[model samples]
Structures are given as structure tokens and as C-alpha cells.
Target: MTQTARRDVDPSTGEAAPPAFESLDPRTGEVVGRHPIHDEADVAAVVREARQAQTAWAELGFAARKQHLDAWRRMLARRLDEIAGLVCAETGKPLDDAKLELVLVIDHLHWAAANAEKVLKRRKVPAGFLMANQAATVEYLPLGVVGVIGPWNYPVFTPMGSLAYALAAGNAVVFKPSELTPGVGAWLARSFAEAVPDHPVLHVVTGYGETGAALCTSGVDKVAFTGSTATGKRVMASCAQSLTPVLVECGGKDALIVDVDADLPAAAEAAVWGAMSNAGQTCIGVERVYVVDAVADRFLELVTERARKLRPGGEPNAHLGPITMASQVDVIRGHIDDALRGGGRAVVGGEHSVRPPFVEPVVLTDVAADSEAITEETFGPTIVVQRVRDADEGVAQANSSRYGLGGTVFSRSRGLELARRLRSGMVSVNSVISFAAVPALPFGGVGDSGFGRIHGADGLREFTRSQAVTRTRFAMPLNPMSFGRSKGTVRRLVRLVRLMRGR
Candidate 1:
């Protein structure tokens, strides 16, 4: 297959054929599947087709849409193992982890389908004393279509955060999965087709960065992106040209804070698992640690013990898996190398830990606060452990990063207080990344971490736009909106305003 967009000549017709790319298994560098590289024209055509499908899908009403969604959900459940196998093959994650991701996707799909009406259906609101003669209502209407650019890590769970909710809100979706996992994206669309079968409510277009960029400017009503912050900016710029709105869920340098009175073993376990799971490709994965001096040594000892024993392989019993993206391997190694060069001590795996696709967990101690390993996202199975004087100092260190995406705090008495201090968008008390699984919590970051949210009530509304409407129930004797008002009418209206205000 052509790596670039250069066309191949077809001998039968003597015409140029579109380019294609291959999705490779990171474990063995073997080709899993090949996908067409959808260009700008192809993306535009898909968006136009989605718009036509969206009108009928939206007219199906909330209850009808939910029924179809429920049918789709059941279909997914019956074929859960099949879909999970596809995820495992393309993304190189262990089968168990792949299954876990599918479970979350199914749960979010159920929640979004079941709750879209209650959360987004038109509802009545009070008109207040001044507008008592009017009936007011606010409804969230579908945006026609949405474009979802997903990541490779947790491919099923992460993209569904936008895809399922957008569909539930009555919008057709055009999904562009990461180049590394295009096969998974295509599989989802095919299964959705089996359930609905009437229209292309969910469409998948595959390729590299150019394909994703094409979707942004393809006239979709909105775009939801999950990737690095740098790429999110580029997507935003492209969407701006078409006046299309975008929701960006970017990378994070998430931190876990350990207090003096915390559960040592649980904190250690959560940290290791959060930082190293799926080869640490999680957008909200824990990357840094700030422990109080009172328990720093104990926490470090426990975390080191847990991280050391973890193994990365394609085996079912392996604690972790290979890095899905090849480019990320260099980024992970750079952070470890920079940290060590800056006088940080390696407690476990170090510069030699990166072994091509699989990187053993690396635990660092006494790392400088401004080191790239602490400031930027590592997105690998490496973590830096820093000691602070107290919980207050720990919060300060955790909030130092420019990215405020998600965080975790392990404290007995002051869990909430410590969690509240971090600048992160979501913080889990005594648990790592707990907020992400809950279908009701808003997920996204502030500043460089990106903007907008996906999941929960907010996520349901993210794919739609709000519309306010009012109707006159009865006419008033005063006729305040008329040009025939007397000079004293203004005085009477002022008195009425005071009366409404109880002045």
C-alpha cells in the first residue's frame, strides 16, 4: 500500500486508484488489515450523506431513537468477544484489557441511550413574574452531524464517549479512528449498520493525519477530538474555517497525591496500574506523584515493589501491553533520559527500560519539579516520585503542570480538601481515574489540556445546540410591548418591577 496519497494505476481501466494504509499489530509488526485513505473529497461526500441520514434519524423521536440504540446495544453485547478481539488485534492490548474497554463502551452506550430524553428532551421552565403570561421552554436540538477523531489507546471506550452520546442526542456521526486502529473503527460502523440497517448514522473513514484533518473541514456540525493537545489545536483550526464547533479531549500529565494517613498498599497499586496500564497510553493516565515526606519513603517502597513485578507482553497473564504508537516510544524515552540527566534517581527501570514496542515500568525519585518528565506528558510506563513537606505542598506540586486534565488523591481525613486543591478538571479521592468510568461526570481539561467535555449530562448536550422558545399564554391589559403606551405606563411598569422584586 502507498504510504502517501500518490495514486496507483489500475491495469484493467488504466485509471488511478486511491491510496491505502495498513494497520499493523505492534506485538509482531504483522499486518492486521488495510484501509482506504479517505481524502478531502471523500470526507466531504460522507458528511453530505450523513446530513441526509441525520434528518430521518432525528425525526425518529427520542423514544424511537432509544429503541434503535437499545437494539444496537444488545447486538454489541452478543458479539462483545468478537469486537474485543478486533480491538486486541489492532491495538496490541491484552484481551482482558480489551474486554474491559468494550464493557465501558457498552455501559456508556446504554446510559446515553436511556438518558437522552430525560436530559435533552424539551422541558418547561418558569417564565417568572414579569413574563407570567408567556409559556417558556428550552430544548437541546441535534446539530445534524458530528465528527469524532479517536485515539488508539482504549480505542473502544474512548471514542464511544463521543460517538454513543452524539448518536443518542439524535446526530449522525462520522468517526475517524487513529491510523493504528482503523480496523476497530470500521468494525464499529459495520455492527451499527447491522442494528439500524436503514441509514449511515455512524460512518468510519480511515487514513492518517490528512484523513482526520479532512473530517474537521468536511462541514460536520461539530467535531469531538481525542489525541495530543498539539494535534487538537490543528483540528480546531481546521474546524474554524467551516465555522464548525469542536470538543477537544487531549493528553494529561495526571498526578497522584499520597498523604501521610493514606492506605499505602492501595495507593501503591493504583499508582502502578494507572501509570502503566495499556503501556501508559491513557489520556488521563497518572504520570507524576507527590507524596508527603512523612510517608514518602514507604510510598516509594510500595510503588517500586508493585511496578517492578509488572511485565509487558501479549500474553494473557501479562500485567501490561506494548505501546500502540511507534512515535510515542521516542517521547517516553526522552522523558526518562532527561529526568535521569537532571539528577533524578531511578528506583526501577531507567534509560535501558525501553525495549522497542514494550517498555518496562520506570520509577524515578527526587526528580526536579520543572523537568520535562514532570511538566510534559510522558504517555508511557514511566513515573516520577516527588516528596513534599505536607499535603499543601503536594497539591502545589501536582498543580504545577500546564495541563489540568485529571488527578487522584489518597488521603484519609482530608481527601476531599486535597482533591479540591488540584487545578484538574476531575479528581478522584482515594481512587485513580474513577471519574472516567462514572457515566454522569463531565470529562475534559482546562488550558493547554484542551476544552469542552464528553460524558454524563454535559456529554449528551455536547452534540446538540440549545434553543429557547416562548409563547404568549394570554394578553395583559397593560400591553407593555405596545407603542400605544401612555406616559404613566412606564411608572406603572417600574412599580410592578419593584413588586416582583419585593422591594
Candidate 2:
């Protein structure tokens, strides 16, 4: 067979194959890179390799592991531009935004490495009076190997939330990045190899949804997934077969609430950025806006003005790049059409603005609460604004969604108070999506937004299993734990309990 023929056929089956796929640039639809479409066997083998590597990795202990992680962070920081270039080419995000993402990932890596020892160390605990003769302690142990199926948007920052924390917690990682951004995944694996050449502490597996399903069932101790709610459900179902624990960071229809006493300009600027940035591909991106009627018109005016000034392009001055996923453009357009058809008015760009890869910022007003545009996760540069009687009504409307991920509240005096009333996992008062940038804050949501955290102290513990240890400190005067305990001993224990309770 000719070279071309060989390339088109599977060598083992001697038939046409589908074991390879291409990554395309969203800006021009050009092929960026080609990667293997890993299957179940490939995923299983990689996981086995990770399991082998994890033993030596866990043996290295926190001090030694921290050294390797620190080296990796330093390497990533020095080559931030290079990786940012790959992210830009693969995800069609502006280079500046790509750099911003890399900066956050690097900071998380440093935080994970520097704090792992403090967070995961074995600590002593006082034994209860009932077990006064024993010493109690608890320590976190690595879960062996971890499987992380990452998202296409924010591929680096989102997955690294789990990958960095998992590694710092001393578990080996097998990463299956979104097929659209395999090059970014390959870059991370290559850089990690440079940091710790002897062990495959981090491995990359590339493919489509089937490949992700493989990872979920590949017998890894844990799985961390970031994607749509539908896909998260599938991942959870697959992991259930093996009883493997999973951390899911799924979809969100987050809202930005503007109280009557809020800063109109600041809230407007924040709403525009939070909704339109990254082509509104953020899981925590603002999809709906609830403004008190007292400032609804002014808020709408300010936001529309800002939205009109922003553009999506490959230029430096552009506020956003193209929609990273081509299919998302159709979804965005559908939501816009649904809103307009349902009597909503487009204050800025409308359905015609969605042209394939590029979707101009869209601002809609007076959209029905039950409309798809307001109810669903419109992962595009579009947001719906609704007028409410007061902050109470605004909060009520914002909390009427199935998702409870991240949210924002802009109020000069009642920011914190109003934010506390929102049913989201993280809410930024007087800011937009600021919680994601803080490494010490936990990030995750409830309901359809999914569960488990990816940052902060909780994040480190997610990849580990708690192991409690108890040892006899000395002989007890009366041993209740023994079956040989006399009836008199039981009576004495009851009397002691009653006396302690002040009965």
C-alpha cells in the first residue's frame, strides 16, 4: 500500500480508521495539530502506567514532591508566552487573555506546592474521654492515580485546578484534555517531563468523548471533570461502575444582580466583561442580569454602551476572540433567536451578529424569565436583563435557576448582605468573577452546576483519602471494648456517663 493508503487504514484491522483527529484554529478553521484518538485500551494502559509511577511519587513525600512541583512552576513561568501562544492558537483567545489564564495557573501551582505540606500533614487529635487511654491522629494519603478530563474553554486554568492539587497531594495524574486543545495538553505533559524526567507523574491522553468515557472507567482512584452538565452526568455514570470518586465542575447560568443602590458604571462594566469575555464561554460567565427597577434603565444604558464598544477579533484591541467551539456559535444563535422570538428586545447585537466563529457581544432586555436565553446556559457573548421591583425580587429571580455556580452582586452598602442571600457556591461583591482568581477560595457549585471543589484547602483534600490512626496510650482501669467486661464495669460506665451529663 502507498503511504497515503497506509495513513488512511488501521494497520491492525486493515480497514479505514478513525484513530486520529485534528485540532483546528477557531480564527481560520486551519489545522493546528493532529493527535491520536485514544481508545479504552489506550486509556487503561496509560492509567496502569500512572499507577506504577504514583508509588515512587508518593514515596518522594511532601518535601521532595514540592521540589519537583516548584521546578515545574518556575519552568512554566519562564515559558508562559510559549504556552500562551499554543493556547491562543488552539482556543482562539487573545494572547493577553491566554497570558492571564497562564498567570492564574502558575499561581495555583505555586500555592499548591508551597501549601501541600501544611495542608496534608498528619495532625494529632485528642481522644475523647470515652477513649482516654488511646492516642488519635489523622493523615491524608494519596489515592494512587487520578484521571482528569478537562474542558476546551479555560483548558489550562480549569483542569490545573485539579491536576496541580492532585499532584501536590501526591497522586499521579492522567489528563485527557478536550480534543480541540490537545496541543495545550501535550505542552503541559512535555513541560512536566522536563521537571521530573524520571517519573511519568503527569501523562496526557487525547481523543473525543469516547476517550473521556474510557478515562472515567479506566480504574483510576478519582476523576475530575469540567464540562457541560450532560457530559458530567455521563462521566458520573461511567465512574459509578468502578465506584471511583469524581469531582465535577459542570455548566452554570450564573447571574449578576444590580441593587437599586449599586454602582451603575461599575456594575455595567462588570456585567459586560463577565458576560462577553472569552466569547462568554466561561462556565461561571454571567448569562442573566437582574436589576432593581429603580436603576434598571440606567444599568441597561450603561451596559449597552459598553457592549457596543467591545469587539471580537484577532487584533490586540479586540475585547474577545472567536468562539473556541464552532458548534457553540449555533447554540448561541439559537438562544438569541429564541429570546427575540419570545418578545425580547436586543439592546446591542442580535442574531445576525453570530457569524460562525465570531459572535459579537449581545445585550438583551425584557427577556422572559422562562425563555431559553434566560433559563439556559448561553455560552456566548449574550446576556439577558430583567427588571425587578427591588433587591428582594432581584435576588429571588436570580435564585430561580437550576444552576448555583458563581454569581456577582454590585452594591455600595449592601454588597455583602445581598451576596450572602444568593444561592451560588461563590459570589463576588462589588466585583465580577473575582473568586476564581483567589487560590485560597473554594470553587464549585451545587445542583446541576455539579459538586466538589477545585481550589483552596478543600481542593487539596479532594485528591486524598483520610486515614485515621489510633494507638493505646496506656492500660485502662476498665476496658469496655473487651467482651470480657463484667456487668459491674458496664454499670460503672453508665453511672460515669450520667454523672458527666449532670443528670
Candidate 3:
């Protein structure tokens, strides 16, 4: 195939020519599989099918929806390995990490299904005495269609946070998986179809950025996007054309804080795993570390040693896999070079060895807080360590970024207090990224990290609309809303207000 043709091939009619997207081993550039996809028109056809399916799916009531979700959950659990391999093949992450992603997704799936009805159920609202004869209630209804634009890293877990919740809340989904890992998305949709066999409630579309843009403008009710902040803005703008709501799970320059009273070994281990796991492709990964002055050198030494042990390669048993997307290698290398040129010293694997796309894990100390490596989201197995005078300084520096997705704090005596002070959606105390496993907690961020949530009760509400209903069962002698109210009624209203206020 021609290089340009090999890059992408859109379908001509409703049927596609063949697989257009190819998964490659970053280390050797060997093709793993060619992911075929239908054309843009076919994508629209899928959305239309989903729209048709949603009418009946939404009417299935919370119990029916939960049953469908539970069936799919069982199927996913039974074939976890098969799905995990697809993730490993496409994103080039270690098999264990891929399995970890699937494990986390199961928790979210279960929570969303079990809690959707309670979170979206209708409840009575108290009306004042004047309207006491009327009944008022509020409920949440599905928004019909939800479009999800997912990222490649942590593909299953990350996007499922939004996808599973949206589904449980009774909305049909049209997911546009990242071009890098289309097969994983396809597999997920196929699995869901097997469980629900009656309709195409969950559909998958594979393409590049253009496909995502088409989804935003393709009349879906909402778009849940997880990618870079720059691209998030564009997605928001495109959605604005139709005033479509979006939940953006964008990039994060998360931080880890170590207090003077922290267990040095435990804190260092958390920092290393937070920054180097999944080759540091996590949106919530710890990109920066702030250690108290008292144990700065000790913590850095321990973390550097641990990071050195996690090397990126294409082998099945490698600790870290090659950079999933080739473009990320350049970004990782650039950040390391910038940090080095800007007065940072590398304590461990800072340079790439002889590998096609595998970049070594990098650990740097004395990096300027204002340097690109410290300030930006490098999305690589690189850590920038800085010494803070105290825990207060660590908190301030951690909240300095525009992004606030995830954070970590390690303190033997003050884990909870410090975890609360960190400005992020969820923080791990003493450990790293454990908040994702606890499906009861909401996951998302404030500011540039985007709004709305994707877990717990908050996530269920994001996919449904609040519906308020009021009905009068009896007549009020002094009807304030009616023009027949007398002067005596106004006086009575004022007296009632004064009595209620205890004035």
C-alpha cells in the first residue's frame, strides 16, 4: 500500500475496503493488525441506528438497563485476557498494565449499573404553604445519544468511566476511539452487542481527527472527550455549533508531595509508579514531585533507583512498553532535552538507548519549576523532582498548574489532611492512583482539566437531564399565582414569610 494510503483509507460506500488503521510494535515497526472501518457515511448510519435503538433502550427502565449491563459485565470478566491482549497489542503497554486497566473498568461498570437508578430517580420537592395543595417532583431523564472521543492510553479504563455511566443512564453511545487503538473500541462495542443482542445501542467508529469532528457535529446529544487540552478546546468549539455539552478529561501535569514525616521508602515507591507506569501515558500520572527539604535527597535517590528498574521495550515481560504512539517519543525527548539544557541534572535513564521507538525512563532533579518539563504534560516515563521547604509549599506548587486531574500525597501522620489540600479531583494518600479503583468516588477535574464527573453518583447524573413535575391536587383559598388574590392575601403572605423567618 502507498504510505499515504496505508496511513488511512476511508470506506467508499456503506462497506469498507479493508482495515485502514494498523497497530505496530513500536520497537520494530512490525504491523500487528490492520483495523478496518466503515466510511464517514457508515458512521452516520451507525449513529442513526443507535438513535433508533435508544428509543426502546431508554424506555427499558433502570432495572432492564442494569440487567443488560450486568450481562455485559459477566461476558467481559470471562474474556478479560482476550480483551487485555488487544489493549497490549494496540497501545504497546505491558500485559499486566493492560489487565490492570480492564480490572479498573469492571469496577466502574458495576458501579454505574448498580447506582444509576438511585442517582437518577425522581423525588418529591417541598412546596410552600401557598402551594402545599400541589405535588412537585424532580427526576433525571436520558439525553438520548452520547458521543465519546477516547484516548489510546488506558483506553479501556479511561473512556469506560464515561461510556459505562452514560449507558447505564439510558443513553445510546457512539464511541470514536483514538486512531492508535481502534481495535479495543471495536471489541468493547462488539462485546456490548453480544450482551444486548437486540439493538446497536453501542456503536464504534474508527478514524483520525476528522472522524471525531464528524461525531461532534453529527447530532449526538453530548460529547465526552479525553485528550490534550489544546484539542479539547477545538472539540468544545465544534460542539458549540449545536450547543452540545461536553465532558473533557484532558491532559494533566499531576504532582506528588512528600512531607517531612512521610515514610521515605513508601513515598519514593509511590512516586516512581505514579510517573513511570504505563510508560507515563496516564492523564492522571504524577509528572512532578515535591519532597520536603529534610528528605529531598533521600527520596530522589530511592525514586531514581526504582525508575531505573522500569525500562521500555517490546518484549512481553518488559516492565515498561514502548511509547504507544510514535509522536510521543519526540515529545518525551524534547522535554528531557529542554530540562537538561535549562539546568536540570538526570539521576537515571535520561537518554534513549538503541531502540526504534523505546525511550528510556528519565529521572531529573534540580529542574526549574518553570521549565517545560516541569510545567507541561510530557506524557512519558519522565519525572521532575523538586525540593520544597515544607508541606505547605508542596501544596501550593502542586496546585500551580492549570490542570487538576489527579495527585498523590505521602505522610505517615498527615495523609488525609494533605490529600484534601491538593487541588485535584481525586488524590491517593500513601499510595498512587488508587482513587480510580474505588468506584464510589467521583473522577474528573476542575479548570482546564474540564468539568462534569465520570464516576459515582455524579457520573450518572451527567448523562441524564433533570425533569421537574408539579401538579395541584387541591384548591388554595388565597391563590397567589392567580389574579383573584385579594389585599388580605398579600398581608397573609407577608405575615407567613415573617413567621417562617422568625422576624
* The candidate that achieves the highest lDDT relative to the unseen native structure: 2
Model 2, C-alpha of 314: deviation from truth (Å): 3.1
Give the alpha carbon lDDT tens digit for every residue of 283-335 in model 2.
Answer: 99998999999899999999989999988896644688988877787789989
* Cα lDDT of model 3 by residue, 132-197, tens digit: 898999999999999999998888998898899999999999999987877889899999989989
The regions of model 3 sitting more than 4 angstroms off are 1-19, 36-40, 128-130, 352-356
lDDT of 1 by residue, 127-157 (tens): 9877889899999999998999999897889
Better of 1 and 3 by lDDT: 1
Give the range where candidate 3 is weakest over 10 consecutive residues by summed lDDT: 1-10
Better of 2 and 3 by lDDT: 2
Q: Which residue window of length 10 is worst by lDDT in model 1?
A: 1-10
Regions more than 4 Å wrong, model 1: 1-14
Q: Candidate 2 has which clashing residue pairs, if any?
A: none
The per-prediction tally of clashing pairs is 0, 0, 1
Q: What TM-score does each of the candidates earn?
A: 0.97, 0.96, 0.95
Better of 2 and 3 by TM-score: 2
